[model samples]
Target chain A: MKAVKVILVLFLLSILVIGQSYAGTIKIGAVLAVTGPASFLGAPEAKTLEMLVAEANSKGGIKGNKLELIVKDTGGNPEKAISFAKQLIEEDKVFAIVGPSTSGETMKIKNIAEEAKTILLSCAAAEVIVNPMAKYVFKTPQNDSFAVIKIFEQMKKMGISKVGVVSSNTGFGKAGKEQIEKLAKDHGITILLSEVYDKAASDLTAEVTKLKANNVQAVINWSIEPAQAIVLKNAKQIGLNVPMFQSHGFGNIGYVKAAGPAAEGVIFPAGRLLVAETLADNNPQKGVLLQYKKDYEAKFKEEVSTFGGHGYDAFIILKAAIEKAGADKEKVRDAIEGIKNLVGTAGIFNFSDKDHNGLDINAFEMLTVKDGKFIVLK
Target chain B: MNTQLFFQYFVAGVTYGAIYAIVAIGFNIIYNTTGIINFAQGEFVMLGAMTAVTLNNFIPLPVAIILAVIITIIIGALIEILFIRWLVSPSVLRMIIITIGLSIVIREVALHIWGDGIYALPYFTGTALKTLSVGGVFISPQILWVLGICSITVIILNLYFKYTLMGRKMRACASNRSAARLCGINAKNMVTLSFMLSAGIGAIAGCIVSPITYVQYDSGTPLAIKGFTVAIFGGLGNSMAAVVAGLILGILESFSIWLMPTAFKDVISISILLFILFVKPSGIFGNKEALNLKEF
Candidate 1:
């Protein structure tokens, strides 16, 4: 009985030592849509964050403190994101949080993160996530408005005045459509027609046919679903023959392969990651872009997408801030805001008190698919 | 509307209609034999397309498609044997819930196997950009293939039901299960055959339409809903009515975009479904007297 009592005391003493050691480590929480509909975005984001954290630990702990990553899979549900956010803040007491991969989820947890005074680096692309200027929240993806402006700038360069817009009824598509409509007049462009189609539509020929009938100078399709590829094919099939512009959501090369020959000459705005191989040696983002592309593709055995790059930017920004401020929550938050010209896979981020997204319209490079591969459009 | 624009809409409607009709026919084949609706019917289609896409990596496209259909048929039989056969006259609601659960399992399994990537089979004859222009109207060659193959499947199914011994026996089970068994026909085996038949046809439709409509892991659910709508619109168990109803729904959906936003396209079709169910529960082609005699 005395020996058993001694063993219990020893076990309890070891738990205290382990708990004390854990307090010295920095805990980073992530709420990602690791499964379900948004898994395409969150899966890559999760994998990238896991990869980067592993690499950081392997190269001696960051500032002599090991990192503990706690990823909560919200499965793209906003309610789940809220609960996960609270849990990460209160229970986990993480130093900072990253992701909630979709815009809706990010928006839902925005206030929770702010109220808790925890730093949040969002991976979603919606402009609203940063435009209202929450003190503690920052987003990594380039603004939807910026992507719209880049497309319109390309359209102006081509002297295309009137264009028809077709977007899927997804949040991404709706946000892009709203940006396109709101910015069209400013760009000296006339919107001939704007149509919203179902995201799961099996055939878009009728929608494309309407666009053809409108006799628009160009066509813009904003969507991230397989339906976008269908739009491309339908436009080609119905002989629309006009230049087609897509949103930054067209970053995945799988869409191009799915569209086959129809993908040729399709233009969209995206980060430099897709065309990193062609970027100039002196380009600020070229090295970061290439390294991430190489590392992610090598580790995951899949084509690197901009979605993953958004997660990469979020982690890199957080890491740089933590390194600079030594894990003090307020100092890390200020350091993140003060960050300037930080090269990332997405763009050279320059955060400030006023601008949280840290990306300009120039962050998007006009890219076009050619011969079933992405290339920078001249 | 201009003749060219009208024809374009017509062609688009027919292409979608063909696939919906095939899916509806798949529903009918099993519904006729077993009172229970197999919610996994759509998964059979997805499985066929996904299997063929994976198989095409190793073998020729034609061979891949054939093997995919056969494999899906076997899967259908196994599903019936494993899940449904032992149940002793299970309630329709219970059976439906079970099938729905089965569909979720299959979809989750598919998600794990395929990951979250969109895949499509190459066009049978030409590239995605290839189209045949007639006067001022354009039509994809794959659309022609879709229409042709779907029509052949329907006709072949009709002939099989009319001429084949197994088909007649299955029909006997459909009309009177106990009487069919008394006449030395194995009603349970007939039910299994019905599942195989439905899965085989669903697989064929999936392979033919996959080039036009890309297949993802969750693609089956939407197709299943649309197919269910078409099946009800035509009548529960009448395959011929499904063809006509499917085309009508497709054309209405395609043309609905002309008057309203394209987002309301599904709304238009589904409203029509509700209208039919409220007014004529027997469906457009279904005889009211015959429907009254049959148990739902």
Candidate 2:
């Protein structure tokens, strides 16, 4: 009886302490695919968001109001996520929204966020998620166009002239094609052959052999997971090994492990800022990002990959907006749009009235798999 | 277009084709002997590769592979006796569902035990990059192993089916279960034998290719589908045709990608399957003069 009373007293006291820290509570909603095929991303994203929120609350909360995280599962479906976003804004009345991963899914709810005048901080890497001028959408991930352009830059340095590109016929892949086409003339690179594979399509041999026949010097892949590995193996089997490259999304341990020996020498453009020890001295988002990296590694029990770091930055950006606007949805929207030189894990966010990505072209980092890990060469 | 690279691609394609052919042969054996399809055949590959990883910690690669095959064969037989026997019926849909369910259970169990991380099995010689040059094309040792192991399997299987009494019983069971049973043959044991053969063949494939592609918890589905596709393309139960079809498909796929973009490669393979369905209708070596020639 005595022990029970003592334990009850401690629990009550802790709750009181927690309550006192967040006297002005701010509700922040996050949507991710917590279950299903893409749960790998959702599981990690949810954990990271909760940790950041807890840390912020412990440190007197964000601007004296504790961040309340309301997370829901989308199961990696885009249509279902639009409903989740609507409910989060209307029923939950969250001041800011965090995620619902992948560009394809994010694009589904972009218009909804805009109509509701909700500030949606998307972590998906599709360029169009922030394009076509959505006032409320700001992306934390590097759009596929930027990633492909980075690859093209590296290809120029390698003296590559012509390349065949294979992209998933999804929102992100289309964006990559747009970027690659725009840069073709500048780099003196010609698009020899282009092929589109649906997400569920497997056994990609005929298309790969066709690319080889077209006399393409290089192959660029813009997809994720087992499919990417399949492409590499098929290309190698057909003797089309002219220094193949992939997008940043393919830089996970899953791709490397599945590709086995095929993964060697495959180059791709990953967000290199995550790999650097620190951003430059004048880099706006350096200090917060360094602290984020330290705290994330300590909490997650894993290395701070770009995904986790992206989550951390997105959280910070949302928190800063809420603090500036006193958790008012309309004011938060204005603050996010008007931001200038706000330091983040990826790079400085210099969002203006016209450009919402806030990225510097200098932030590009080209990488290749070396001994079963991504090594940034550019 | 180059002679050496063409040779390289040819050898590599045939080598991969051999692996798929053996997997298809295993599928055909179980399907023909028993009136069921084991979608979990890929899990046998996962099991074999994972077993090699564990055994290779203590034993040599060859010993590990042999042990993996033996254990998988036993497991294959046990699963048939315990689960598949009860589930087998005249309803084809039910059998397919049961096999799919078994595959899920096997996959989840493997994932629970091993987690989702990919494991790299060491190559037999620890020399994956060192290639055998013929003319101008380079061939890796993995290709050679896939070819040599598959050839040995085909020869042994040919001999077993042609000369051995047990093999004759298996063929009898496969051709007609009721007739084989009425003729005093133990159809149940023959069914078990088919599973044993399949699991062992799949294990062999896993052992040969694990050092090349490695293995993960969910690596079974695509391999199963490819093997199934190959089996279907060959006339379902025809082992020789399956091998030939696998090689043809592999080579055609490898060379066909040279004419299209690499992304649309899957569509091309699927299109060929559709084309075969329309033109040949009964597959490459299908049994003729039969009204309803069911394929596994």
Candidate 3:
């Protein structure tokens, strides 16, 4: 009887010690598409988060407390994302959740995060993720509308009033198409022809010919698929010599290589990360962008993509919020909204109650493919 | 549409048609001998192109293509020997399932090896931007290469089947397996030879078209579906009819984009396939009596 009582007392004391140590750590949950079709987005995002967390932990973590990150790979499935979001909220009880890489998965769990009052900083590009403005749901990627506005603003400078839009039938392409149509008229532009082609289309000659028939001043191809590279090649083959505009999806150097010589002189709007070396030395984002690009390339032995930048932006934003709020979920949510002029790889973010994405048209830089490489459009 | 635009669409249709016809010929070669669809036919094409692209890094383009086709032919022979040789007259459904399973295995293995990156070979005559213009119509030189190689492949295959002793033995096995075995011919070896022949042709087609269509790990399935449609429309075992059927389907699909949205292009082609199946089960050129004699 005396040994049993002593054992019980010692077990209680050990539990107290373990529980006390865990109390100072901030637990963050991330659901990303690490293996499926969207792995292009999620793989880099996951790597960036893992690198940043390790760096932070080595530096004594945020505000003298260690950070515990839990990453869940959804393989770009919304159903898995829903289950993971619920599990992270109810079971793991993480203070905050960072991503569900693609826009579809992010939208699937937006309400769950809102109801649970856990902060969700999504790395998706869809405007719908934040336009409704759930108090607890914020996003890191720049809005599709901002990208569209930047493209239109450049078109206006070139005196191009009529354009043809071709997009793939994917969520990213469809969302970009809607934004382009919605903002074209506001920018004094007229869309002569709009077509949605299959994402797996082997040839896009017929579609490009239709744009030629319409006599549009410029052609805008909106897709993240290899079909977009086909579009560039087909348009050049048919001798449609007008300027071509691609979506931010053309940021990958692989696409330029796939299109080969045809990719030259093609323009697109993208984040500053692609042109990080060309930015002025004193620019606020230059240092952050270069540091991230250098660190990511060195660590992964691969080129740094903007998709990873989205994940990087989410972490830094969350770090700033946690620094100010100090592990209080409600306070972190408010602190995120109150963050202003935070330098990130995507852009300088200024969050407010009315806006959760916090990026403007200026966030996009008009980039062109020149000599088979991305350069700032002069 | 203007005459130039009409011609432009026509050229596009013919380019894709030649590709489909080649793949359909691959299907017919296997279906003729084994009575199996060999759904992994498309993977042969993918394998050929991917191998050539990798080999092109260390060797000249023409030599790389030849080596890739030979490699794919060996793989085809191995697949038949390992998977189909000991089946002892397997049911048609069983063969179909096995081929489908094999295709998935090959695709996954390719995904692992290649890492899902889209790759294309350099154009043979000129760069991607170079085009030959006749009147107001612009023609990509790569399209001409696709058409010429397809025609040459079909001609060479026809000659081989007509004049070669080995080809005659394979045909005998295809016509009457038991009788051919009694006549001192190895019917099983003929099946392996048919697989190699089909794989070789598929690889040739894959290499010529990779410059225009681009090659990826998963690009094979869609090509396979289109090729299967052409095969069915042309009569399952008739290679010559496949050429006509492929062109008709391709031209119709391209023109359908003019009347409807581009998203419905595949819908129009597949609907034609359904209509053909419902109206004439033996296909446009298939003899009803001959189809009745064969086992599906």
Candidate 4:
């Protein structure tokens, strides 16, 4: 009994000491869709954050204080995201948070971040996250508006005036549709046909047939996953000769393989990370992009996607802020807003008081599938 | 509508209908023997497709397909014996809940094994078949494959139920379990056989449709729902009705995209199912006795 009592006391004392030491570290939390339907986005995001955080720690962390990263898997559920955000803020009391991979989940946690005054550097690309100018929230991925602008500009250059828009009924697809509808006319493009499809739809033949009948010069498919590949297959099978443009959601090479031969010549707007190796010698984003591409590919054994790049930017920007202003959440937020000309994997980020995403149309590169590989579109 | 566009929609409908028809047939085979809807019927299709895609990396396409179907049948039998058989006179509700549980387990296991990425099986021909245009309308060879397999499956099932003694015994078990057991038929074996048969059919459907849609861990639920709708709308246990109903549902969905917004495809599907239930509670060809008996 005496020995057991002494062991219990030693254990309690060690726990107290360890806990006190841990409190000295700067805590950053993350809510990512790591295991659900959107795992494709979240998995890479989680990996990038983990790797960057480890590297930061190895370099003696922020201001010689170890950075503690608390990552919660939201599983792409909005309720779970909200709860995770709340837990990160109220329980973990992290100085900052990063990611809630999808637009819908980010939206669910936006208010919580503002209320808690915690810096939320989200990985989602929805314009709504930063449009209303939440005091504490920002994002890393290029917005749907930028993608739409790039696509429209490409269309004009290609001398294509008429286009069909096919969007999935998901938040990402709907958000892209809204931007496309808003920007089409300004670019002198006609919206010949706009169709929405079930995200799980196995076929888009009927919709593509209608687009063909309408004589659209190009087709813009705004969605991800099995639907994206299925649409391409259906379009190819029906012999629809028009150029096919996809959303940045097509950044994953799995999509190109799934679409098979149909993927060839399909163009989409994506960040510079996709063709990092091919960037010009003096390009601002080239060095950071190549390093991240190399590190991520070497570690994960898969090609780096813009989704992962978003996570890398989040950590890179957060690291810079922490280094500048220490671990104070308010100071970190201000430091982030004041960041300028920070070349990242995504773009040359120029955050300001008014703009949160800090990426413009220049951040996007129009890429096309050639021989089942991504090539930079000229 | 122009004839070309009309034909395009027709082909789309037929191709989709072929998948739904196979799912419905799987439902019918299980329902006829067990008197319970196997919610995992869709997962069988998913497993079949996923297995074939995974195996194709090592084996020839035809051999991969055969292996996939056979593996699916073994899984089906195991599910019946390991899980469903242990129930002590399971209520229909219990059986349904059990199958739903089974589906969740299988889907999660698939997720761990395959990861979240969507996978596609190579086309049987190794490369895409060029569209064969009739006048202005176009059809891919894969669609033809889907149609051919569907027709062959329906014909085979029809022949089996009518001419085979084992098939009749299974139907006998479905209609009156105690009576069939009294007649010296092993009702339990019949149930296991039906599950294996249904799984084989479902696997075939998955393998064929995969080239068009691609398959992922989560693909099973939607396929299951669509198949369930087709089965119910066609009269639960009647295989012939299931095929016709599946085709109708597919065609209606195909045209609905042109007639209304694309988001309404799922809405139209559920709405039509609800409307059918309200108008014809026995389904289009539902046997009044069987339908009423299963209600409990």
Error of 2 at B186 (Å): 5.6
Q: lDDT per residue, candidate 2, B202-262, as tens digits?
A: 8888877765555777777767777888887886766777888888877766665555444
TM-score (C-alpha, index-matched) for candidate 1: 0.97
DockQ of each: 0.87, 0.30, 0.65, 0.73
lDDT of 1 at B121: 88
Candidate 3 accuracy as TM-score = 0.93
Which lDDT tens digits does candidate 1 get at residues A1-378? 999999999999999879856655889899999998899999999999999999998887678778889999998999999999999999888989999899999999999999999999999988889878999999998888888899999998999999999998999999999989999999999999999988888889999988988899999999989998999999988888999999988888889889988888999999999999998899988888889989998999988888889889998998898889996899999999899999988888899999898988789899999888999998
Best by TM-score: 1
Ranking by DockQ: 1, 4, 3, 2
Clashing pairs in 1: none
User: Candidate 2 — what's its lDDT?
Assistant: 0.74
State the TM-score of the second chain for every model. Answer: 0.97, 0.93, 0.97, 0.96
Better of 3 and 4 by TM-score: 4
> What are the lDDT scores of the predictions, listed in order?
0.89, 0.74, 0.89, 0.88
Q: Write the per-residue lDDT of candidate 1 for residues B66-153, one digit (tens) a residue.
A: 9999999999999989998898987778889988998998888898999988998889998888889998788888878877877777
* Rank ordering of all candidates by TM-score, starting from the highest: 1, 4, 3, 2
Measured over the true interface residues after superposition, the C-alpha RMSD of each candidate is 0.8, 4.7, 1.1, 1.3
Compose the digit string of candidate 3's lDDT tens values, residues A189-255: 9999889998877888878888888899999999998898899999999999999999999999988
Question: TM-score, chain A, per candidate?
Answer: 0.96, 0.85, 0.96, 0.95
Query: Stretches of candidate 4 above 4 Å error?
Result: A1-18, A21-23
In Å, residue A284's CA in model 2 sits off its true spot by 6.0
